[model samples]
Target: MSGSFSLFIVGWGIIMIVLLAIGGFFMFRKFLKRLPKEDGKSILDWEEHYLELTRHMWGEDEKQFLEELVSPVPELFRDIARQKIASKIGEVALNKKQKQITRDTIIEGYIIATPKRDHKFLIKTLKEKNIDLRPYQSLFEQA
Candidate 1:
């Protein structure tokens, strides 16, 4: 009876260890999934939801709109738009070496396409998609 009881203890220890290992493995996998890729570029999880709204908003003109939306006034406001966008990009970026210059620059320039009073429309649209307009405000006087 003593030997059989000792064996049962050993078996229970093995079972507990296996259970802990399985739990640890799943936890580790979950952690790894949140980790960025080796290239330091990762698809943000919120992008899909944001993009869905943009798709609905832009419809067939998504690419064209994003393209022509920037500096739409051409030769007249081109330099003003460029300078304002660069200024806004500087504000949003933490440091000079920041890689986030392009996006906010474009958003700022897009704002230039609209009248100051109508800027709220674009801001509201972006806000609905969970996009923050604070970082993208350049053409406004207070930005």
Candidate 2:
């Protein structure tokens, strides 16, 4: 009976440890998500910077198109992902001194902003939507 009780206690302890580990994992992810960038800019600051840089160039139609392009992102991260993509796009447009955002501009920005690990998903999404990969082959190779 004593041996059985000890085993039960051990099992409970292991379960508790696993539960704590799972909780910690989620907490750590939340903490990382809110962590400031190396340059001391908050996520909101970056978002605003991109928006300010590109606002004048974005028409209603282009804004709507961007939203549609980002629709595949999971709901929880969609806004942040959209902001990051837009930031890249804005940066590219600013560098080129482009007067407006074109489809190619959006595609190039999307490729540059997305991580290499996610390029497969990006390619799949683009293909499903009938976007050609030929124009952006170099971007994928570089990534």
Give candidate 2 regions above 4 Å deviation.
Answer: 1-47
Error of 1 at 119 (Å): 49
TM-score of 1: 0.30
For residues 29-129, write the lDDT of model 2, one tens digit per residue: 76775678998876657667877989899878778877877899999889878988998888888888999988888889899989999998898988987
| Number of clashing pairs per prediction, in order | 0, 0
Per residue, candidate 1 scores C-alpha lDDT tens digits across 44-68 of: 3222323332332333443343444
Highest-TM-score candidate: 2
TM-score of 2: 0.71
- Consecutive 10-residue window with the lowest summed lDDT within model 2: 42-51
Q: Which pairs clash (backbone N, Cα, C closer than 3 Å) in model 2? A: none
